[model samples]
Target: MYFSRLTFNPLVSHQQLAQTLLQDTYREHQALWQLFDTDPNAARDFLYRQVLEQGRIKYYVLSEREPVDRSGMWLVDVPKPYDPKLVEGQRLFFTLRANPVVTVATAEGKKLRHDVVMNAKKQMGFDALPPADRLPLQQIVQDSCVPWLQARAESNGFSLEPEWVTVDGYQQHESFAKQQKRPVRYSTVDFQGILTVTDPVRFRTALFSGIGKAKAFGCGLLLVKRV
Candidate 1:
């Protein structure tokens, strides 16, 4: 069960973007380096080849030590070049494939979908990036899809890291509200959702419960748990 934000931006080229964005996010991303197995660069190479190729990467944009932008995606055409000497001994570069969970719903309420979208913010090894506003163009891939990636990671019990090519959670986040340019000021994105299980058998049960019963209503991504 993973959530992902989707988008398309025709601007990306700073090859170092991927390394810059995720460098600081390692703890939350590739946390259990030992417990999860392998050394540092083991996981970094995966993301560099997978996510960055599509110009997609995940991050929690911060401001003054507070999270200002919850999470979002940026899509662009340019690519962040892979650099091994920047940090760990991993070599990184761009690719041309899409990651899962990318969508294209307008702010009004629409669902444009795709299999995999380009990611631009990928780099080899690891290192810290610049501040948000000061973030360079190479670091600005238009389609990020961080939410879905993150959600998938949480459900899988493996954190996201540059080491892995395809991250479980890319765009999943703490909000059901429309993706925003920045985080909400007052009220937060309403995460009130339904934890539902649906299969051929469960659909029979859903048939019994009317739509107005609050059991089955919203038509967003449905997280299905086996238990």
Candidate 2:
């Protein structure tokens, strides 16, 4: 696998145009698609995360193949081959932006994906509560998102303590696509903390293939480093 960082060229004259293009999620996806536009029929096999620092836009991408800079607008870092050596009982600090959802079956047995945070709010009847009785928003986010990650960790070959992780940045996004009538909708939550590898093999799969959904829209890329 290859890991790469992509950023707008500071020297580019169209800074404002670049910023505008990046603001639209669909446009951003199209721009990034140029890197892997080798096969017209190829399915997406990469995970990315968008980061904003000091008003500058940046993207981190992990893919099965090296990314090429087809557009002159980006300053593409040299793609580095990534193959982390892991061991059972290893601990590492990790950061992830994930689209967390739960599957619920309807009366007719149709399964639907619901945002975990929204689901929690619905289950708690948050909207019906008196203003003074409602829990802090951050508290609700933590309560809902932490367990969602923990449950994923258990099956993904890792373990996390609720107190060790910080969860925030819950946001809902809607982006229009010309090819589709309805807008693409999804929510993102950021998680940062330490995790221990209970099974290296499964952990490696999770790292390479990503965890959770919406991989195409800059979610589910698990970034990790030594503790």
Assess each prediction's global lDDT (C-alpha) against the native.
Answer: 0.27, 0.88
lDDT of 1 by residue, 1-227 (tens): 11222222225445434543443323233321222234554432111111233554432110111111122224322233321122222222212122243455668898854333232333311124445434443222222333444454333222333333322232322221233555321110111112322133333222222111111111112222221
Best by lDDT: 2
TM-score of each: 0.19, 0.93
Local error of candidate 2 at residue 20 (angstroms): 6.4
Candidate 2 lDDT tens digits, 1-227: 99999898776677655654756687777678878885646788788889998888799999998888765777889999999999999999999999999999999999999999889899999999999999998898899999999989978999996788999999999877557888989999999999999999999999998999888788889999999
lDDT, residue 197, candidate 1: 23
> Deviation in angstroms for 93 in model 2?
0.4
Separate clash counts for every candidate: 56, 0
Which segments of candidate 2 are over 4 A away from where they belong? Answer: 13-23
| Candidate with best TM-score | 2
Which residue pairs collide in model 2, if any?
none
lDDT score, candidate 1, position 199: 35
lDDT of 2 at 219: 87
